[model samples]
Target: MKKQRVVAFVPIKLNSQRLPMKNILPLGEYSLSWYIFDSLLKVKDIDDVYVFCSDEEIKKHIPSQVKFLKRDRYLDGDLVKGQEIYQSFIESVDSDIYILSHTTSPFLAANTIEKALSKMLLEDYDSALSVQKKQTFAWFEEKPLNYELNNIPRTQDITPVFIETSGFFMFRKNIFEGYRRRIGFKPFLQEVDDVEAIDIDTKEDYEFAIQVYEQVKQRAYINN
Candidate 1:
């Protein structure tokens, strides 16, 4: 059997309302985008990794080893959907699978991405998405319909729902060949905890992520 050709696509914009230049902002020693890019690059199965950005200043900070996809002015707005950028990337690259990842997800591990990709291929699923399972009692319209105490059953026992982490997505190129969206039929789920799947959208989010990263790094050091 032939090995699958996988390309990792990361989309970033210069003008961010929530957090200005969040991608280029320093997380630890390197820019947050670089961490995510480097992590994906370390994955053995991923053949190519491309960073799509609009600002040339942001490109200057990225390593030369990584490839770049310049975004047109029309697609540089905050309102522009990320899916559009992803579709354009798919058209530019020739690969069996495309792995879409966000630069904000700095804590995304290489092992997790590889596992998700492996599961998607082995199970013959059309796509795989990273999701976080909600455990707390969720409600709407101020109603206490489904009440559960401290010893409540697992979320699956009540109403199991997965929130999209927007961290990573693995899918075949053919799935997005004709469609405008990234999702497809026969999609598989890769369950991830909230901490590892943190996405930086605001200044508060960035600070919180820093704390998470420090804790994770310290724990890893101790374990190793």
Candidate 2:
């Protein structure tokens, strides 16, 4: 059996609608964009890591081991859908398995990624994605979805809802090529904790993430 090629890429655009140039926002010694790039490179299963960006400036920030794939700026437009950008990337880089990750999810742990990758490869799952388990009362169209209004159950007792996070998505090449989706028919929902689920999108989100990151680092320092 031939060894399956696993490639991971983080698509970064210089411009952002919310929190302008949010990707390059300073987290600590390194910028916000550095965390995910550092994390992906640590994953042993991943053959190669690439930063798919439209600007050449991003090349300076990424690690030397990580290859830079310059994408067309046209894809960075607000009108352009993510699927179109995804299709463009997959076409450029051929791999047996591809990992789609975002810089916004800086706290997405490598162990979580490894576990998801293991599940996908071992269990013959089409794809694996990070999700947050919400066990609270949920409603849709002003109607209760998880619980009934008549019998208000405890949040703990309620059926947990799995919400997808921008943490990561591991899928086979065929899944994307065939369906044009990161998720397949059979997807393994890898539940991640609150800390690991931090996805920075807005100004508030970024601030919160910095606070959490600092706390985590302090805890680690104390432990060591």
Candidate 3:
């Protein structure tokens, strides 16, 4: 039996309109991207961890032990979609499983990544995306169908639906052999708590993530 090869890829760009140099922004002792990189490194079965960035500052902040892939100008702009970065990583590396993570998710735990990958492998799914369960009455148009004035059920009684975090995505490389995006058929959902799905897109988001991290750390300490 051959060991499964899982490669983690992180796409980071230099220009962020919301928070300038957000990826390298200091969280605690290390930069934001470093936390994500280090978190992936701690995962049990991950074969490699690569940080793909166009900024020289990001490269400097990251340790030498972690792999670094210099992103081209074509893939470095703010307007470029995440799919393009993911595709660039796929074209560069060869692995059975590819894990794409965002540098902004400082609170992403190693255990979550391991569990998601294990579930995907065990169930033989083509992909696994991290999601959070939502129970609110959603609407596509103006009219409400599920919850009417006459029949309004408690929010807790409603069926929960999963929403992708857009922070982490994993898939078999072969499943997207010809495709350019990360999403694919036979995709599995790795449900995560809403608190853990903090994606730092702005200053407020970054501050909120810090608070969440502190709370989690305190809780873990109390439990232990």
Best by TM-score: 2
lDDT of 1 by residue, 1-93 (tens): 888888888877877777887888887778888877877888888889888776667777666777887877777776878777776777777
lDDT of 3 at 56: 65
Task: Tell me the TM-score of each prediction against the true structure.
Answer: 0.87, 0.96, 0.89
Please provide, for model 3 over 1-224, each residue's C-alpha lDDT reduced to its tens digit, 9 standing for 90 to 100. Answer: 67778999888887778899788887766788787777788888898988887766777767666788887978877578877777777888899899999887777778988888898767778888889888878655786645675787899986666778856899888777767657678888877777768789989998887887778778988999
Which pairs of residues collide in candidate 3? none
Clashing pairs in 2: none
Residue lDDT tens for model 2, 1-224: 67789999999998998999988888977888888989899988899999999998887666778899999999999899889888889999999999999999999888889899988777889998999999998888999889988899887799888999999998899999998889998999999999989999999999999899899999999999
Per-candidate Cα lDDT values, in order, are 0.80, 0.90, 0.80
Return the top candidate by lDDT: 2
Q: Could you tell which candidate, 2 or 3, scores higher by lDDT?
A: 2
| lDDT pick, better of 1 and 3 | 3
Worst 10 residues of 2 by lDDT: 56-65
Task: Find the 10 residues in a row with the least total lDDT in model 1.
Answer: 143-152
Clashes of each: 0, 0, 0
CA RMSD of all predictions: 2.9, 1.1, 2.2
